[model samples]
Target: MTNTAPSLVLPEISSARLTGLLEFLQSAEQLKDTLRSGTTANGRPESTAEHSWRLALMVVLFEPELKDIDLLKLLKLALVHDLGEAISGDVPAPLQTPGDNRQERERRDFLTLCEPLPADIAEELLSLWDEYAAAVTAEARIAKAFDKLETMLQHVLMPRQEASFYAFNLGYGVDRTDCSPLTRQIRDKVDGLTRALMEDAGRESA
Candidate 1:
């Protein structure tokens, strides 16, 4: 006698859900057009997408220094940290003032971006953004450190005028007194890189 087995059926994804996800993905592509302060090796303005990509890589490269942190969560945080720029455009550091509401604006923009996604995914993305912005968790703090380090590294590597160089130094000089050991290490590296760049500039001027 032959035995018949029941076939398992999976629920079909809703067309509305798929459409919303697709729309969100298309919206994220606009991040490539969000210009940041940093320039490429060829002197082109860098995009927020490029910054986010390198930041995630920086997190992995500095993993040995990070202690008791979730690498996966840190990576996710790095990627979404600037997703708000997709909607709000990149706000360069030097342009911000003491009373600027840029952070609040970015948070609102990020929420708007997530509004098209499924409820659970939207919640997760919003939470990740908030956590990074708050810097309350170890992962969030590490992500923040990597973000700053990446920006400083770009300034060190890129060619800049005296005014731009001074602006970069003033904006990005990380104070390590209150930072975690891993963050402090990254900050020291940035300081050394900046010093070397300044010496090179001095030589070229001479």
Candidate 2:
């Protein structure tokens, strides 16, 4: 019978599990529609998904400098850091208040989103999200720092908004971004860009 290559076999996955996975992914598509406060160079409101994608790319580009950190974990943290925004949407940074319950709300939404996923997969993702929310691990901390930097970079590069918009970024997440010397240096560079943009906006309004 020529041994038939030892009869290849593959593990079976229940159809229900497969369906749940696909449903979860379909729900995640909402992220593509959740608009953030930042605009593109062309002045279109940027989506949360777009911001997350760029955040991941930023981490990959700086992987060489992010010594002793797990690159894969950093990327996952970046991607899912805002995944909950898909449901409740992003509250504009300027409107956010101290003790606003934003983090709690987002975590609830994240847990709901993972409900359709396999238990093991859901737990793993929840752990990552929780770590990022807490900024507990080195990977989580770096991801948080880059998250702030990426938002600052976007604000500065996008078409000029009101001077207040640029100013808002100057003081946005200093504590988070100040986690490391390199992150502080990057924040300073973005702050410089933000100042130039603020000036340009001021000139226009003058």
Candidate 3:
């Protein structure tokens, strides 16, 4: 557990209510230590918190281009899209098998993680998560695309991983990214990089 607590600026509220909010936020801090399958440039495992941070950053950076969408809602979707992973950890797309019930498991975990928050706040977060999970709304769809792109971006930009790692990304998450022109453009570039990495990894092995 991270010993350092964040300096939160909360509005004036009842001590009990404030304590509940603080406890929920504190539990959420565990995401900083929850490792994902990807690694940093230095080869350290990336945490779920880092992934969501970048995902939200992606939304902010692309805000001008995404004027048609609800930027705030989209950002929220991105931030919470993988909040479930903070509880159950992440399952890399390539390793996920059919019938794994990963979504179901993650949904349950998300509910548990949100238990400390007020009922309305928790329900709203869950609804956003579910929207992202289902990719039913336009904002949700874009969030999913950004999420996939961010994962692939990290993989390609990181130091040369195994040949299979590069190979796995070639066909990974196409369906999600293909939904938007901006995302598709980004995906194409990432795919090109992935292919280059694949070729390089193959040559080094040969």
Ranking by lDDT: 2, 3, 1
Residue 186 lDDT (model 2): 97
Local accuracy of candidate 2 as per-residue lDDT tens digits, 144-188: 999989888888778768898888888999999999999999999
* Candidate 1 ranges beyond 4 A from true positions: 1-12, 163-167, 170-173, 176-178
Q: Tell me the tens digit of each residue's lDDT in model 1 across 85-108.
A: 998998877788876888899999
What's the lDDT for residue 117 in model 1?
97
User: If both were scored by lDDT, which would come out higher, candidate 2 or candidate 3?
Assistant: 2
Quote model 2's TM-score.
0.91
Candidate 2 deviant stretches above 4 angstroms: 1-12
List ranges where model 3 is wrong by over 4 Å: 1-11
Q: Could you tell me which 10 consecutive residues in candidate 2 have the lowest summed lDDT?
A: 1-10
RMSD of each: 5.1, 3.8, 5.7
lDDT of 3: 0.89
Sort by TM-score, top down from the best: 3, 2, 1
**For model 1, which pairs clash?**
none
Compute the lDDT of residue 32 as modeled in candidate 3: 95
